[model samples]
Target: MTDLLEQAVLTARNLPAERQDDLARMMLSYAGYDEPVIDLTPEEEADLIEAQAEMERGEFATDAEVEAVLSKFRP
Candidate 1:
């Protein structure tokens, strides 16, 4: 098999039983076999809710702050 395929098989084999299905699904979706499924757990849902609340409360940086952050990566 190709190096990439061999690596994928090895990585999948190392995942926990619960995670192997997720990994397989992701690989299938990446290869265009199916739409990606997002069966989020409770913690993920809570994090999304908290992020939305923060946005609504204006808990964000200013334009200058954003630019300063992006400047670090600019060539």
Candidate 2:
């Protein structure tokens, strides 16, 4: 391993277990592993289905609407 990566692993080893797990998850995601699948609640599933129907019907937000929402986060 490169010196930088070795140093990072050594530092990670000293972190709390929860932090270590978070780091491991982040590294796995960065390495292109798909996140674990989660079962959605009934309400969430219904919402997703409705969203898909809206997308199929071209009822999604316009580009201007999207930019307007994003602008709220800009400095």
Which candidate comes out best when scored by lDDT?
2
Backbone clashes in each candidate structure, one number apiece? 0, 0
Model 2 C-alpha RMSD vs. true structure (Å) is 12.3
Report the lDDT tens digits of candidate 2 across residue range 1-73.
Answer: 9999899999999999999999998888876689655679999999999999999999978899999999999
Tell me the deviation in Å of residue 64 in model 1: 1.2
- True-vs-predicted CA distance for residue 7, candidate 2, Å: 49
Candidate lDDT (C-alpha), each: 0.89, 0.92
- What TM-score would each prediction reach against the true structure? 0.41, 0.50
Strongest candidate by TM-score? 2
Which regions of candidate 2 are displaced past 4 Å?
A: 1-34
Report the C-alpha lDDT of model 1 over 36-73, residue by residue, as the tens digit.
56778999999999999999999998999999999999
